[model samples]
Target: MTFALGPRAAKAGYGLVAFDQAGSTNAEALASARRGDTRRSWFVTSEQTAGRGRRQRPWIAPRGNLASSVLEVLSVAPAVAATLGFAAGLAIETALRQVSLEAALRSGGRASFALKWPNDVLADGRKIVGMLLEAEQVAGGLAVVAGIGTNVVAAPPDIPTPAVSLADLGVQVTAEDLFSALSDAWVEYFGIWNEGRGFGDIRKLWLERAAGLGQPVAIRSGHAIIEGIFDTIDEQGCMLVRTAEGRLEPITAGDVHFGSVASQGAV
Candidate 1:
């Protein structure tokens, strides 16, 4: 059950710094970037004490789960940098399929893994993986950390968003095994991303595996609520929602609700 990089990642010159426990793998990766450790690397752990999700929400990975982040230094604008999350989503979804035989068998079915808009991987419409992208201005370039957390053995209780773990769905996988798969898949998707140049391909693949495409969606952005059909993401990764009036509105950031939750207009 030791954590180690897959052959693909290692062969691609990616470094690894595995932690038994950490406050936040993303924070650790960013700190390393600030310290001029700009080499592309992954900071991963099974237990995270103080992680943050979108809008600064706390996201802790309890024991037996996976809390991992990979640092990439690139010469891309922040707008382009933001699109990397899509690649991260694809990586984890691909990895989940690779590690879990059940996940592979269920692919293209209702209970398969799919990417929820922005930064979540859903299994049977319940979230199993959450991702966060953080960036900082460094000496050489933009340092971006893609943080990925997977519920391996257990999911948090009483969460606003429905959550599920691999074990819960009958796909038993260890954190170490999952990370190995993830590292390999990341190498593939990261190459396709090509520091954002390959985002077009990523976007296309993402839309193909999107969870709520063509469904009613309600996005809570600040104090405004925008309700519409999930149209697609634009070239720059802004979510394009087709409203009732037939106008396509671009959402830069928001909390997306779908299905019954969107019907009720809940956050």
Candidate 2:
């Protein structure tokens, strides 16, 4: 099936450019922005040849997988734009629930979907979706691109954390169907985000679907490591970890590991 925006997204004036294959949706979106295509738009493809996640980690979406990015230009600081990633996470989580009946049936039962902090979506404790947000100052405003990738047919192998595909969960979902749902869900949550003005509500809702909350966690930030409990995120979306010494430490960025992997410091 070909990709088409949901009714809500179309009505909200979101534009789309669907490609049979692309190097990177995020890179395409940013390049468009630099060329003055600043209107809110989506760049999507099923076969992404070259993509990178946070910390420049390689992420490849083979044929039948979903690689999508949305671009928004606003007169906000990069700090405020960072909070928008929360809305992106929420959108993908909502879309996964909307498209997968098997996932819905498994919810609160066996394998379920949850949002991982910084930018990931987890299914059955394995990574299923990954996200990256990049921004650049353009002529009109700060151009922000939120890239989201979902494992529809296959998952990358030999990763630090195990990855799962929708097929693995008995979810017979197409990338086009999931993208349609995602476009609609993005309209809903991005409205709530309101360019960071409604971040309090986003933070609250994100915690509701957040994985690893109140669980033992370890965050590897560069050469150092911070081990603690996954308490909550702050108003600005910074993760707050309650250490063993009773201090609530704020972490801006890290490679996080939860549950037993944290306790064993295996990550």
Candidate 3:
């Protein structure tokens, strides 16, 4: 069965689609987009069996978690889709803040949530959400699918890092409510994209919510690992890190690890 977005989301012009179960929202979205679907849809699932993360890592989605993929059919180049990932990250951060604040108000507890560079959302320094974006070439341009998985009730057991849930944090949020907030956030974030701003605004917003800035970190790209101080992101969305040898390195793609030097690490 398919689930549609709520009235608030409908007013935002996002077509919300929900599924009881799916292998992967990103996979389903790509398939739908290739078939020329112009729905501008948000595909949310109750659970995902084969969710994927950056660099083909496994994305765990428990029953009560949030699993969603937002697809946008773009007339721009595929490279622009990469910039959209930054926008998506910012959107998720915004949504987290909204729900966390409400949860805090309801429970009278401290609300703590932060964002890791690229696309990881954390609560009290433990990971609570992760995102994966995939793009495909359609007839006219590229179809971008951004998949977001947020732990709401249960945590996975196989990951190296510690995982936390909203329930564990004293914030009880339902998957549907989280999806509503996310859909609204995406509508606002995508407006920046439609303006042809080229990720400048998104970059600024990301830096504001960034977990590590001016800190030493390690970036793993392909077979090479570079250890440096995280400086800033370049215009092309590449990560700028200062190495131990006092050299500046631009990272196009890699896994970032926060160092132990109160500012330096690698993942």
The true-structure Cα RMSD of candidate 2 reads 2.1
Q: Against the hidden reference, what TM-scores do the models get?
A: 0.95, 0.96, 0.92
lDDT of each prediction vs. the true structure?
A: 0.91, 0.93, 0.78
- In model 1, the worst 10-residue window by lDDT is 102-111
Name the candidate that leads on TM-score: 2
Least lDDT summed over 10 consecutive residues: which range in candidate 2? Answer: 102-111
Q: Tell me which of candidates 1 and 2 scores higher on TM-score.
A: 2
- Candidate 3 — what's its lDDT? 0.78
**Least lDDT summed over 10 consecutive residues: which range in candidate 3?**
258-267
Error of 3 at 12 (Å): 3.7
lDDT of 2: 0.93
Cα RMSD to native, each candidate? 2.3, 2.1, 2.3
Clashing pairs in 2: none
Could you give me the TM-score of model 3 versus the true structure?
0.92
Q: Per the 3 Å backbone cut-off, how many clashing residue pairs does candidate 3 have?
A: 9
TM-score of 2: 0.96
